[model samples]
Target: MKRRFTVSVILSRCSLASSWIFYSEYFYNYQNEGRVEWVYGDGFAHNLNNVNNLVSSLRFVGDEDNWKMDSITLFEFDLFFGIEYYDWTDNTQVPSGMSTVGSLIITGQNYWTVYTSTNFSGNRACLQVQSGQYVGFAADLDEYGIFTVRSYRRGCFGDKKITLNSDQHGFAVKARE
Candidate 1:
């Protein structure tokens, strides 16, 4: 028998000088037990007006000693399955077939330190980060028959002409008779 699922996207207003963007997709199989999976893409951008003015003014006054500022772009994708039982023993490990190019970190399992790297894929499975702890569970596996998927970004401050953008999107599923 097939099961029913629903998805939603909630967005907050962008800051006066900031912007946020995010998108995500989800999949699930209830007949096979309570199996759930999802993937998301997020982007962040900030304006650069102060830096530009500082450079131009220094050049005009012939005082171009040197000035510098840091700019960063962060991108991430997360894929995982949710189960009802706390024990993940029979969950199947499958790849999403999608990749990202940027600074990335993947962590799961309780009390385990974050693994920092340029790329991460397929090495870690059945592990989840919840309440700052890494927990593992199985797929098609349901004890309470409920699961959740989520993604988001936090905002920060900036100067004039400098705008920041933040956005997020994802999905979820629940078992019903």
Candidate 2:
């Protein structure tokens, strides 16, 4: 019954970092046209000649001089489109066919908090990225009801900064140092 990818930390300067730091991998197909497939850390999506999903364009290599190492990609369908689960650390349960998370993407600098209940508790949403921009895409999160995300973690549990909604795709609620 060891269904983990699990994590449980609530502020107090929550901790959990180190997934083999290495920012900016590679994957291109369309406009970026031609061969270029290089991703370390994590697993899956090595289509090569077949080019599994034929990624049109991609680039989310965390650690732009260290943004908490950066990494977070979860999509089971929505604007981001089906099947994809990447991580950097922190999860109370999520990594087995990925329960449900429609769409979400964030890279570098830090910001993440998703819980529908698990070790992190219930009903919470905060995903940030937009200050010089590294990467931050929500695509669709059911208007913030969150489909089913058991638990998640990265940064921003609360201590100061706040920005719930706005342009360039908003989602912010940071604090914890």
| Model 2 segments more than 4 A misplaced | 1-38, 41-47, 52-55, 66-70, 76-100, 103-114, 117-120, 123-147, 155-177
Q: What tens-digit string does per-residue lDDT give for candidate 1 at 26-143? A: 2212132132222212122223221211111110000112101111211222112211111112212112331321111122222211111212212222222234321121222122
Question: When superposed on Cα atoms, how far off is each prediction in RMSD?
Answer: 21.8, 18.0
Tens digit of per-residue lDDT, candidate 2, span 43-157: 2222223222433443333343343356777766444443567787888877767767676666665678877788888777767766755456665677555777777898877
- In lDDT terms, how accurate is model 2? 0.49
Top lDDT model: 2
TM-score of each candidate structure, all chains considered together = 0.15, 0.26
The TM-score of candidate 2 is 0.26
lDDT of 2 at 135: 57
Span of ten consecutive residues with least summed lDDT in model 1: 58-67
Please report how far candidate 1 places residue 73 from its true position, in Å.
Answer: 23
Q: Give model 1's TM-score versus the native structure.
A: 0.15
